[model samples]
Target chain A: MIRTEQAEVVYPNGTRALAATSLTFAPGAFTVLLGPSGAGKSTLLRSLNGLVRLTAGKVVAEEADDLREPHALRRHRRRTGMVFQQHQLIGRATVLANVLTGRLGYHSGLRTLLPFSATEKRRALDAVARVGLIEYALRRCDQLSGGQQQRVGIARALVQEPALILADEPVASLDPATAERVLSLLHGICKADGIAAVVSLHQLEFARRFADRIVGLAKGAVVFDGSPSKLGRAETLRIYGAEPADNDEDSEEPLQLKTGTHA
Target chain B: MLAPSAGHIGILHEHRRAVLRHAGLVGVIVLVCFGALWLTGFFDAQRLIEGGPALGQLASEMVPPDFSRWRAWVGPLVDTLAMSIAGTALAIVISLPLALLAAPNTSPNFAVSQSCRLILSALRSVPELIMGIVFVAAVGFGALPGVLALALHSTGMVGKFYAEAIEHVDPRPLEAARAAGASRFQVITHAVLPQVLPQLADITIYRWEYHFRASTVLGIVGAGGIGFELIAALRVIRYDQVSAILITILLCVVVVDSLGAWLRKQLK
Candidate 1:
């Protein structure tokens, strides 16, 4: 479980990126943060993994105040897998190699010098299979499409077997179709592995369709927190500065994505 | 009424960028003044006239090439190559640790990194020829002293390159490794090593080839190499032997250059 209590972030120049906002995500829950640009959505996601230090208040993950010390926070970060909006995959490395980086916490010393152990290699391969990129494991990550690269990012996170996954605007750069597919895979993986997921989204439609629960933030504070069905036009207007389309307006039902298959 | 009330804007914005440009011009003016002060009274026509006559006299002594002691020069050329290879090898071994310690981002303490850089700067401050003379006195006149001198000089050079290489590496991988709970050593081995290894190889080989040429010159001070033979040939007025030695040195330099090129390509 990940929780933030009145957590606030102030930049060095006194820009308050996140205000006194508090949020909690249940275990195995797929929660989406819906907001517009500069709404502190990314800041909130970074706070969960202790990537962004809180100027005041506490960030608790797995029942510990994560923003305690620099070194201690780093250890907590290992348990939480983070996906950047850019995918942040090391493009030069092979897909398998990039995925195996997720297991860095498990090895030390000359163990890392030698080739990764067979069991660890198997686990990494299993993650590639789970992401349905087993065929491209040997290929370089730079060759993959934007959607495929995001999947590789998911594969990297899956390899960690993390307790919680924080994806900051995971699909903001992807196309609509590709965005839906990537979100579906992320949702399926989180559900299967029982990992709490906090995915930030700029698109209200994708968040509404996929997120198990939706949280709205405006000016670094949570304005609404409830089920997707309960997210009304008033909250959307407040979060987005414009009324969003009704959730039931779309004809398609909720998507059921396969583990390794594209929806 | 608003259309008829347009205010005249002054030339205030015209000189906004002029301030920085004038600052740069002032900096150049200061440098020129210092350069003029430093170079004042350094040139003399009479000294050059005297030096020119001496150079002509020296040139007149060399009438023809005499290749009599080709065998004698060959041994020393081999010695030069051996000295360079050994010195570069030793230099690489010593500099790797010093470079890692000197990298500000990698080292834990600022003082340690600063001290490491200071030590390298001190080593580099002394000329290689002076170092050779000092080593020869201590070790009693052998190729070992020459190699040690070159190694010490090359250590400073390699350490500088290593520090630069460390600086140029992408910080993202290191950040990720730190986030992954990797120990300092693990982060270095996984994140730092892979990124810089190929570049390290390229620079190391290039330095080795460079030192190969420098080792020949170090032999002039009895540090041991073809330079000793060249000096002897000049003293004996054996221009042929000098020519032979010079040709061999040229060939060796060409070979070293090609080898450097090959190694660089291989690394890529």
Candidate 2:
């Protein structure tokens, strides 16, 4: 489990993205960081992975080296996976090649220059199949649709086999149905593999319906940290602001958290 | 950031005045440049008119491009091609690493990047003809000197283009690789190499075509290529032979240009 001990991050431009926040993430659980845009959700998530260093306090992980040291930080990152909002797939490469990048962290530079080992190749293919992109494996990534590209991004993260996965708005650009499918696939894969997943989402309904534990963030502080069942209407309005009606969102959307292992 | 309002007559008039002032400044600069040129006696209308009959006479003599000297022209043409190939190949090898060093993002430090830029500028300052003369003095006249000159000078131009291209690569893939704990070298190989290799190939082929044309002229400095033949023919006033040499160089350049274009298309 990773925990931030009163962690704080203040950008050089005097923007306090995360202000003296304390949070914990457990293994094999789907924890969604819920907030509207500019809610410091990304900064909080990045701080956990050492991508954004806290200007004060400290972030620590149990059974792992201190992230304060550079070498230890890299080692810790090797065990962690990240999926970007833009998918960040290498556009010129084949789908399989982008997935093989997941193994880049595990190989030496000279070894990587040579062809990937048969074992790694097989793993890459398996990852592609896991995301149902087997047919597109040999195709260049730019040829894929936005939804397919995000699926490839998931395949890339899956190939890493990291103990924890951090997704920064993985489905932000995707349409509602595609977003649901991608998020469900991601949540299913993480749960099945017993890997912890921390996904940042702006959609209240999706976060409420999908995440096992939802961490609400607003104005750079943890506003709520509890099970999805406990998040009341007042808390929702408070987190997203009072204009939920004017924002054209359903005021009372059902929060049916997925139960029974998705077979 | 405020937009100028139409109601502000003073501001509108000032804008027009600023434009008129700039135009006046440009006119004065043009006048000064023309005055300097006149004072130096650089413009020679008489010499231009006087050369018309002589040019016509030379053109009349060059009517039959003497293909009888074709046997003699082949060796130097081949030598020019060889020089271009060798020079371009070596330049690519040398500049590839330097381009990586010169790029702002990939460079080890700002000092290294600036130093590489400085080196490229210094190398590019001297024209390839001047470089050929220098090399011919150092290494003696031959295709080797021509190759050395072309390679050294083209490195600067090609390296700069490469640095610019590499610097413009999207930052997303780089961040993904780095976040995966990829070392700097690993990130370069995995992220940077794939994106820039095609562009690098395209730039190198274009430079090769340019060097091919430059290599022909390099022999004028006694570096040994077709230019030596052309210059020799010109000195003796053999317009027919000069015409043949010029035609051969033109044909070679056109062929190389097509080949370069085709190869670049393939890379794309």
Candidate 3:
């Protein structure tokens, strides 16, 4: 479980990116934070891991009760895994090598220095298999498609084995179909692994399909947080300030069979 | 369709301008080269011709090359080679930390990186010969001074190149390492070092070759090496002995160059 109490983030330039935003994340659920650009979605996600330090209030995440000391923040960050907007895959390294980096926090300084042992290699391979990219494990990151690269990013996070996964616009760069597939993958992985996942998405349909709960943010404030069935057109207009022009007109819309399995 | 205007040039107009610019640049280069040759007296062909026979006769007198004193000369030659090796080795050791400190991203603070860059620039501004003279005065005439001069000179060159190599490293791996909770040291070892190692090896070998060349001349300041022998040969008008030393130096340079190339290939 992760919770932030009146967590506020102010940049060095005095820009208040987040203003007293507070929320609690339930475990083993796929939570989607829906918002427009500059709505504090990314900032809120970064705050969960203490990457963006909060100028006021406390961040209570699993295994990280405090954020005052830099050392403690780093130690707490180990339990929080984050994916970025750009996928942020190391383009020059092999896919397998990139995934192994996720295990860096678990190893000692000397072990990190030495080459990966057989057991470490096996674990990395297993993570690769989990992402369904075992065949491309040895391929360079640049060779993979955007969807495949995002999968590798997920694999990297999975290797962290974090209690909570924070994905900041993870599929924003993929095509509509690919985005659907990736989000479905994320939903399935979170459910199976029993890990809490907070995925930020701009597209409402995709969020509505996979999210157990959708948290809407407008102007750096959480306007709505509830089940997907409860998120109606009025609430979305409050979040986006306009009715989506083509909800029924997506040429490649994902086949929404059933909403996320949750009671 | 838009007409070519003062603010914008057409393809043909730009092509003509480019030709004019290149022509002007070449003209300036030729003029500078001629001016330099004239100032240095290198263009005085008549003066060179007048000394040809005297130079030939002087060269002939030092024949047999005075190899009978091999015992004396061999030790100084060894000393020169050792000076090169030791100086390059020391420079390599110092350059590693200096490179990390000089790198803007890898370095912890901007002030530290900037200060290290400034210090390297200061060291590089003084030539090895000047460094040799300064060291000789402080430490007395010996290979110790030569080693110090070579080491200091190479440190400047190596550190600058090494920092550049560090700067060009891909930031993605570093980000991944950081996100994975790797400490600064681990990030440097896993991401930065591997990316920069090949280029670093190339730079080190090139520096070694350059230091070897510099070491041969360090003896001119009484810093012990074959340069002392070369100076003695020149002072005594034993041009043949000088010629012999020059040939040996040429051979040694070629050997080192080839060896360095081979080692670089192996590293690659």
Assess each model's interface with DockQ, reporting 2 decimals per model: 0.34, 0.53, 0.43
Alpha-carbon shift of residue B53 in model 2 (angstroms): 1.4
How good is the docking of model 1, by CAPRI class? acceptable
What global local distance difference test value does model 3 have? 0.83
Q: Ten-residue segment with the worst summed lDDT in candidate 1 chain A?
A: A254-263
Off by over 4 Å in 3: A107-118, A135-145, A176-178, A243-263, B1-82, B134-144, B222-229, B266-268
Better of 2 and 3 by DockQ: 2
Candidate 2 clashing pairs, residues 3+ apart or interchain: none
Least well predicted 10-residue stretch by lDDT in candidate 2 chain B: B2-11
Q: Estimate each model's TM-score.
A: 0.81, 0.90, 0.81
Model 3 error, position B161 (Å): 2.4
For model 2 the local lDDT of residue B245 reads: 84
lDDT of 2 by residue, A79-136 (tens): 7888999999889999998988888878765776788899989999999999999999
Candidate with more favorable, higher DockQ: 1 or 3: 3
The DockQ value obtained for model 2 is 0.53
* lDDT by residue for model 2 (B37-137), tens: 98887687787688889889879999788777889888988999999999999998889889899999999999999999999888888899999999999
Q: Distance from true position, residue B205, model 2, in Å?
A: 1.2
What is candidate 2's local distance difference test score?
0.85
